[model samples]
Structure formats: structure tokens, C-alpha cells
Target: MSRLPLAALVAAFFVGLAWFVSARQALLLLVGVGLGSVLASTRFSFTTGWRRLILSRDPRSVIAQLTLLAAAAAISMPLLARFPTELNAALGPPSISLLVGAFVFGLTMQIADGCGSGTLYKAGLGVPLNMTILPLFALGSFIGSAQMDWWLALGNVNPIGLVQLYGPIEAFGITCLGLIVLALAALIWSGKKTPWFDRRLLIGAIALAVLMGLNLIIAGQPWGIVYGFGLWAAKIATASGFFNPSHNWFWSQPDNSQILSQFVLLDVTSITNIGVLAGALLVSAGKPPARAPRLTPTQWAAGLVAGFVMGYSSRLAFGCNVGAVFSGISTGSLHGWIWVPMAFCGTLIGVRLRRYLNFSG
Candidate 1:
């Protein structure tokens, strides 16, 4: 069948399922597909964006991310204020665990060459390394979630969300102002000659912001990745009788218990995550062929290790690029801001490590 026909069939399936299941989930799937399509089409990558800026003075990708952050904040704040019942912020406490996790996640993304979303979308696009990393990442998320209570006990303050603390107006102003300053600093540092923006990148950034905001509106929660990945692994482990949820701190919660008992598709994040993979595959099918990476076995091993660490650390730290950085900052959570700088520092170290490993791109 032609791509259009295939697309229609897929849409019909999801739509019918929506009728049988819930309208909100269908919307979440559509949003995920939209996010994946944009991510694939533009190759917008938080991992490379940060790495490039740190190592090569390339700010184009980083600028796209900042644009994304600004748009998400703008769209998110009003919705959060007006519809507090239906929406949730991506908030996490600022603590030693968060600082440590974000830094490790940052370094891992640089070494593994993909963030949470990046790994998922790229794996869907048939990138070998990402395909390998994705599974490891999931497993790590599962392990991390299982151990999160212990991590939290190390030292954690209550989460500080600007929306909850100061209301939408102040939150938006603070976030946008900070973003503008960061953007200007990036531009100045990248030098005067490099192109300030790419049309596709800018469009992707805005589209992503809109979609993520829609995710909050529809899912009754902000966008998240690690939680779903952990759920996936948890379900499998439970099914195999290798793990029990009855006593685990994270899994034993009432809400989580309910989710674990249901079909994965009924879960908002899993459905959305699947949609991202599907949408990426669809887009890749239509796009020109991509050159495969040239990587040695040692490099692959390094990436796998890094991927595992990325997932585990993300869970410990409360989220990855999408959860902690994108959703967190967009929702005016202090953890989001905290994650960025620490991850950047980790990226600095990762870049240096990459050279030593002879994994230069």
C-alpha cells in the first residue's frame, strides 16, 4: 500500500481504539506522532545541540531548543493557571540526587549520543546505536525507579514550581526573561557570522512547544519519558514474576498500581511513546536515506554503558531531557533550571571523554 493509505489505516485503527478506550489517549497519541514527525524532519536534538555548543561553538541547534523552551513556557503557563484541575506541572525537588543525576544524564547523552527522546526517535529511524541504547535505557529506568526512594532520602527539598508559587504571569515572565538572556549569550558566544536560525528548526521548536502543551492539557500531566520506560520494564518484570510491585516505594503507590494493572496502551505516556516511534518511522520512510554511523565494537560497548547510565540517572534525577529540561523549565520548575547547567557541565566532560575514546564524529 502507498504511504498515504498506510497512514489512513493507522489513523483509523487509533481512532477506533480511541472510541473504545478514551478520547484523551487518542489525542496523546496524535501529539506524540506530531512530536516525532517534527523531531525526525528537523533532526532537532538536545544532546547534539548542547554538545555542539560546548565543543564546536555551534549554536543553531541550541537556539532551536531555547525557542522551544520559550514557546512551551508561554503556552503552558496560561493553561496551568486557568485549568489547574486538568493540568499538571513537571515539578521535581532540587536536591543532591537531582544535581548528581542531571550531571550524569548529561554526560551519558553526550557519550551515548542521544537523550531520552532522541534515542527513541532515532531508534525508530533505524539508527543502530540508538536501537541498542534504547533497551539499555529502558532497563536502567526500571532499576532507577525501583531505587528512587533511597535516592530521595539522600537530601531533597520540596519541589519549587513558579506556577504554583507565584502564579502564571510571574512564572512566564521569569522563564521567558531567563531564556532570552540565555539565547543572547549563546548567540554572542557562537560569534557574529553563524546563521542565527534555520527555518525548519524554528518551526520544529514552536510545533514541539505546542504539542507538549497539548500533552499537558490532554494527559492531565506534563510530558514525561522515564516513567513510561520504567513502567514498561516493570510490567515485563512483574509478568515474569521477577519483580513485585506490592512493596516498592514507587510502584506501590495507588496511582502507579492502577497503571501497572492496565494495558500499556491505556497509559498516557506509553501510548505517546509508541506514537513517537511510529511517527518517526513514518517520517523516515518518506525522507531521503540517511548515512549510517561508522562505529567500532568498543564504541558500541561504550554507548551501551552510557545508555544504561542515562536511563538510571534520569530516574534518580527525576527526568531526562524531555522530562527534566523541556517540561520542567516550561512548567517553571526550579529543577529544570538546575538540570540545564549541571548537564552542560557534564557535557563538557563527556566531550573530552569522547576524544579519548576515539569516537569523534
Candidate 2:
């Protein structure tokens, strides 16, 4: 059978499964699939965008990211305002936990060569390292969540959402202004000016923004990735009896315990995660497969360690690049802004570590 038809058939099967599960969840799954396809086809990546700007003075991807943030904020803020009860912003506390976690997540993702969304979509494309990272990342996320309360106890504060503090329109304006200032700063830092965006990247950014906004509308929450991974691991551990959802502080919460008892498909994040994997696989089937890079044992060891750390730190920080930085900032949460510079600082360190570890640039 030709690849496209088979892919379509498989997608149809999943669509059917989603519908059987719940209409709302089905829409979320399709949105996730759409997200994966775009991530693969456009090669739109948060990790690559940040790395290029940091190391090579390339600003195309960075600008694209900022544009995405601005567009998402424009869409998300209004929806959040109109349907405050229905839609929840991606808010995390401005705490020491966030500071440490975001920084560690930044360093690890760079070393591991993908963030939450980056890892998922690439694994969907059947990238070997990312495929490896996915499982370990899940394991780490579970462990992190199990200990999340301990981390938060180190010092935490209430989450501050700009949309809540200022009205939605005012929050949107502030977000846009902040993004513009950051873009200008990035431009100055790069000192290697380029057009604001090429046709393709611009299209990709806009498409990503629109889909993310839709995700918020459909899911009744902002787009997220890591929570899904944690859920998968938690379910597995719970079934195996290695973990007890009722015993752990984080997992014992009313919402968490309820979601745990339900099937994976019923969880918004889990279904979307499944969709991401399937979507990436569909696109990858038609493309030339990417070859796995040769790596020394040391490099392999470093990568695995980095992957685990990224997963664990993400929980402590409340999200990864997409969950915390992209979705977080887009939704006008204070911690989302906090994640950016801290993660960037970690990126600086990670880039250096990559060289030392003998990994290819």
C-alpha cells in the first residue's frame, strides 16, 4: 500500500477511537496530531531556534518563536477573559522551584537535543535518540511528580497570572509589548540582521499559533506536553504497584487521583500525546528516514542522563519549553517569563557541555 493511504487509514482508526472516547478529547487528539505534523513538516523547533540564536547569531527561529508567542497571547487572552471558568491558563508559581527546574530543563533539553514538544514530535518522526529519551523522560517525570511537593516546599508562592491581575485586553497588550522588546533585544544581541521572517517560517509560526489557540479553545486549557508524559508514567507505576497515587502528595490530589483511575484516553494530555506520536509517524512514513548519529559510550551516557534530568526538572518547574515557556508566556503567567532567561542561561551552559561531551553541534 502507498504510504499516504495507510497513514490516512491509521489516522481514521484513531479518530474513531477518539470519538468513542469523548468528543472533546477527540478534538484535542486531532489538534495534537495537527501540532505534530506541523512540527515535523516545518521543522519548527524551540530548541533549534534558541540554540541557533545563542551560538550562530541566527535570529530567524527566535523571531518566529516571539511571533508565535505574540499571536498565541492575542488569541488566548481574549478566550480566557470570555470563558474564565472554561479555559485555564498555564500558570505556575514564581518560586525557587521554577527557577531551578527551568534552568535544569534548559540545560538538559539542549544536551538531549529536544524539549518536551521537540522530543515528542521527533520521536514521532522515529528519531532514535529522541525515541530513547521519551521513555526515560517519562520515568523521570513520574519521579519528579512524586517528589514535587518536597521541591515546592523548598520555597514557593502563589501563581501570578497577568490576565488575572490586569484585564484580558491589558494583559494582551503587555504581552505584545514584552514580546516586541524581547525581539528587539534578540536582534541587538544577534548583530546579524535578517528579514523578520521568510515565507515558510512565517507560515509555520502562524499555523502553530492558531492551532495552539484552538487547543486552548477545545481543551479548555492552554497547550501543554510534559503533564502528559508524567501521566503515562504515573499510570504505569500505579498499575505495577510501584507507586500509589493516593500516597503521594501531588498525585493524591482530588483531580490527580480521579484522572489516574480513568483510562489514558480520557485524560486530555495523554490522548493528545498519543496523537502527537501518531501524527509524527504519519508524516515520517513518507519522508526519507533520518540516520541515527554515531555516539561514543560517554556521549550516550551523557544524553541519557540529560534526558532524565529534563523530565524531572520539568515537573519541578511546572513545564518544559512548550508547557512552561511557550504556553506559559503566551497565557501571560509570570513564571512563563521567568522560565525564559533562566532556561537560556542553562542553554549557554549546555552548549558548552555539548562540546566537552564530544557531541556534534
Candidate 3:
């Protein structure tokens, strides 16, 4: 599609959202668009960044991610402290579920070659593997959500909010200190020979951090990705009589049940998810299609299975890289802090599996 038509389509959707939903929803669609555009333009992928660090001792992307975390925390912590009632942090309990889920999610994301946001934008850019994995990811997310109660039963602790425990300034300072430690570790591991910065990635991180702040302001919640996918799948399954929300602990919640009966565009995450897809499509316009990876049948099946597991694990982990790691840490949720090392450990194993599966791109 040409840029003109693509832009027109996005505008039409924006108008439709404003008319049918609310002005805020429409604005969030634009936020999602910006997210997709920045991600696609800069190739700021959480999955690849970690993978690079693990395989090549490259610190550039890891440093960029730390910068992103620092920037987002600076922007969001104060706002969260200021508007405690209006806004919600991305909080999840520290539990057995989190540890196992984050680890598996990290592992699967490496094999699948995309985390939530990475999968969305790459799918938008028309990557065949990601496009195929999207639905399976949704299916797995729904299944994981349905079984959440069982996971929680294993063992869990109350979620800790740094902003709630400490003042915003203190929380922000703590966040910065943590990020600084990680950045220094990455730099030390990679050595002085390896460059520590990528201009495009730094720019993208700053842009995403600003947009994340906007997301919290407009939606009254931090940015998220997997919930929307599970919701979509739940709606479909419920409509088809394949699943019953009332029997499911997670979906039986007042808010979750209520949204099931409403339009998807009315949902904050869904709208942004749609917007991310559209934005990526917009970026792809007037450009040559990206080359798809080649793999054997076994590799293809492995990837598809990885996508499903990644989806399932993301829910159990309380969020993927974007929702759990990015939003969690930025908003002062301690679960985000716990999620990182577990996911990184998973990635350590996953990269090996990727090589075993003979996946190359």
C-alpha cells in the first residue's frame, strides 16, 4: 500500500475510535502507532538485545534498554506518585509462577524470535513466522490466564510497589541506581572495545519512554500487550462456546467479564495493540518487504510451539518484556525487578536451543 492510503486508513481508524469510543482511546491508538513506528524504524527489540548480549557480549542494546528503563522510570514514577487514584501500576506478585513463567517466557521468546511487542511489530511488518505465531500466542495466553488460579495456589507473596513504600523521588532514585548497576555490568562485560551506545536505539528508547508516559496519562494505566491478546482469544472462545468465562478465575473478575461483553475498541490494550499493527503496516508501506527466515519443518514447528509457550508463560510471568519488564520497573513494581534475571536465565538456555534448532536470520 502507498503511504497516502495507509495514512488515510490510520486517520479513518482514529476518527472511528474518537466517534465510537472516546477521544482518549483514539489518542492511545496514536500512541501505539508511535510505538510501532519507533520500534520498527530503530529495530529496538528486547528479544534481540538480550540475545546479542548473551551470544556476542554486545552491550550496546543492553545499555540502550537500561537507558530506556531509566528514562521511563524518570517519567512515570513521579506521575504515579502524584495520581495514585487515577493511574495503576503494572504490579504482579513475587511467586513460584513468576519465576517459572518468566524463565520459560524468556526461553520461548528466544526460540520464537520475538517477545510480545517484537512479535506484534514484526507481524505488522509482514514477517511470516511472527504472523503465523500471533494466533497461537493468543491461544496460549488465553489458556494460561484460565489456569492462573492454579499457578497462584502454588505459592505467592503480595506485590511490592516501591512508589507506595517509598516516595516517588526515592523510588525513582532506586530505579536509577538499579539501572546504573545493570548498565555498568553490561559495559564491563562487553569491554571498552565494544561500543556502548547506538544513536538510533537511544533515540528510540527516549521516544518510547515519552510515549509510555503518555500511555499512563491517557489510559490511566501503564502500557501492556499480552492481556489484550488473551482477551481477544477469550472473547472468541466464549462466543464459540468453547470456553466459559464464569468458570475461569481470571476472566470472571468484574472488569474482565464486563469488557468481554463490550467492543474491543473500548478496551485500552486492544486498541493500542491494533494501533501497533497498523503503525507497523504504515511503516512498511513504500518499502520492500523484509526477507523471511528459512527453516526446516522441524524448526518451523519448534518456532510455533515456542510462540505458544511464550504466550502462556508471559501471562504466568504477569507480563512479557514490554508489560512486565518495562512497565513493571518504570512504575515501581518489584515484580519487574524479579522478572529480569529469571527471564535472562531462560534466554541463556533459549539461545542454545535456537542454535540447536538451526535458526538463523
lDDT of each: 0.88, 0.87, 0.93
| Model 1 pairs in collision | none
Deviation in Å, model 1, residue 126 alpha carbon: 0.5
TM-score of 3: 0.99
Worst 10 residues of 1 by lDDT: 1-10
TM values, all candidates? 0.96, 0.96, 0.99
Query: 162-223, model 3: which lDDT tens digit per residue?
Result: 99999899999999999989988888888889888799999999999999999999999999
The collision pairs in model 2 are none
Candidate 3 accuracy as lDDT:
0.93
Q: Write model 2 residue lDDT over 48-131, tens digit each, in one string.
A: 788888888878888989988988888898888888899999999988889999899989988899999889999988788899
Better of 1 and 3 by TM-score: 3
Report the lDDT tens digits of candidate 1 across residue range 273-353. Answer: 888887888787756555666999889889999999999999988899999989999988999999989988888899888
**TM-score winner between candidates 2 and 3:** 3
Q: lDDT of model 3 at residue 10?
A: 95
